[model samples]
Target: MKKYTLLLLTIAATVVILIQSILYIKAGASAGKTSGVPAESLARLSEQVSVRAARRGNPWINLRDGRDLVAELTGADQGLLAGEGLAEPMALASDDFDEDGTPDLVTAHRAAQGGVLSFYRGNVDAVYPNAPEAKARKAAGSYTDAPFLSPGRLLATAEPPDLLGAGDFDADGHRDIVAAARGGSSIYVLSGDGRGGFPRSKQIQLPGRVTALTAGEINRADGLADIIVGISTQDGARALVFEDLRGAIKAAPESHALPATATDFALGDFVDGYETDLAIASGSQLLVLHGRDRRSAKQSRPRITSRRFSSAIESLATGNFTGSHRFEVGVLSEEGEIAALTPVKVKSKN
Candidate 1:
């Protein structure tokens, strides 16, 4: 009876050890697999939320919705909102307005006095920038998706401005603004101080109704930016190039005539390897002034080459949005809708 009882006790110990060993192997196998949700699910979620950003070498030209950016800048004000307002985008430019590492937007307000230079500072370093992050942070008792308008100051203007232009006018490694007044009485050249302030206003007298205004290194050798404006005349539209002669600014005694029926114009290298090419949107035609030099005392004019478009282009924004190192022209309709047009070399009749 004692031997049988000892054997029974040993058997019970062996059974408990075997059960523990089976549980350990099962737990190890489970640990080897994912805890919850699979890798494929995460990839699908990423695909649903994100888009393929366009990078260099592969050009993707499509209409992108800018309402979110606009809303962040002007909460309730929709007057200057692009795609809604006809003359919404007076000037669309990017710069580090707040001296931040990321670039910010500088555009006009759609109000009557909108030309006073409205700046939308970049929100690159925001805490709760996305939806998921915002939701999580909100549950944790703290949440913020930080501000787009970072301490904006409206540089006082005499009258409402019709057009806004920017360049390193002072050549002080900072961007200076050139605003053409709506009344055609004054053209204000406010020099930027790297901070979002223009203490002094160097107002210049205008010749006539200037439709468009922009700045570029019109004088190649000088390497300093010069102010260029489009003048509406009896015959047609004209390009009035003004050179920044250090302190004071000087323009051609007479305005250079653009292509037939020129409505608006902007300075850009529309052609590759050419600098300061004039791009004029005349009615429904896109004209490029190739191999032109505006620095000459003897009336420097651009050689006009044009392409016909389906609809009239109201304004021009020149930049490399298509991953091209060279500049691409973004045309806006009267309705403020924008579409990018890439430049191609066209052979003229010899």
Candidate 2:
């Protein structure tokens, strides 16, 4: 018949080239197993979530349902590279203190002769690496001062003093410890006795030179906890809002004014949700202080609604990446270039 019909058309063109080379090797091994991660572990988990959203900027507002959060600090080589820290990172607010709801990290170390508070006990994943420098110098030598050495004079190596939140300032619900003393105007309060110890009690003092502290409940009042202190003299930046009652502190007309040099301050809500709003970082801008109706007749003051980065804003944090609650301003330049402002949507109404 014509050579068996040309050998059955060359065996059906070699079975359609062997089924397209086995579907091109199974589509390149399913694209290497669907993007197989590992680009240096996704750039070290995007630099540890951009260095924990540029250092503690989400100053807590509920959060403890699934809880896995971890953020610990150490000055990062002390050039004061970002938010100027030789020490000052004591935050614990999401409740659970170790009952296991997960939210624990209370730090304080100004050791020359006086401060060294540390209590970290929350682990579902990690954040434990701190209590072993000879057991934090034997629990800071049973306090009374003996472990704060450094050219001493009452332990003066200074620079580590600015942490301003942890709750229950002595209504005895638990959590307590608030700090801020870069040159002192007083606001220390450390009272935790629910079982993990924190003796030092009160010291409110404020008028100027305090620079950044945050905590809020702002008159929605459940048991009281609202203090926002952020002074800085030469009569320019201000933010004192105090109202704690249990540990005692009154002054609350809800002040707010800034233009240059405020560095960092946070208390969220953003606007018109009518509760918390006071995010100031001034000096490359980002200010949004709205909270009127203390009986409102007039008193709005606090405009500048975000002008992020002309450079010179060492820190200001409140993050969500892009999933929700924005405003993540952190800029460290003098030639370090960290950059991150994110939170855009403006047209007017500063």
How far residue 326's Cα lies from its native spot in candidate 1, in Å, is: 6.5
TM-score of each: 0.58, 0.25
Question: Root-mean-square deviation of each candidate, in angstroms?
Answer: 18.5, 22.6
In model 2, which runs have C-alpha deviations exceeding 4 angstroms?
Answer: 1-164, 167-175, 179-185, 194-199, 202-212, 215-229, 235-280, 287-317, 323-350
Q: What are the lDDT figures for the candidates, one per model?
A: 0.56, 0.50
Superposed model 1: Cα runs more than 4 Å off: 1-92, 110-116, 123-149, 182-185, 219-223, 234-236, 245-254, 259-261, 292-301, 308-312, 317-350
Q: Candidate 2's residue-wise lDDT over 1-350, tens digit each?
A: 89999999889988898976664443333222213333222111111232223233446543322322222323323222224444444433333343333354554455333344445433321222232322332243421111111111111122354454777655667766577765566777766665445655666676678877777665334565666777777777776776545533444435566777576676655554555556676777666665444434134544446655666666656655454555444445434566455543333445
Instruction: Supply candidate 2's per-residue lDDT for 137.
Output: 26
Q: After superposition, how far is residue 185 of candidate 1 from its true place, in Å?
A: 4.5
Alpha-carbon deviation at 228 in model 2, angstroms: 11
Q: How close is candidate 1 to the true structure, as a TM-score?
A: 0.58
How far is 36's C-alpha from truth in model 2 (Å)?
52
Which candidate wins on TM-score?
1
TM-score of 2: 0.25
Error of 1 at 120 (Å): 4.2
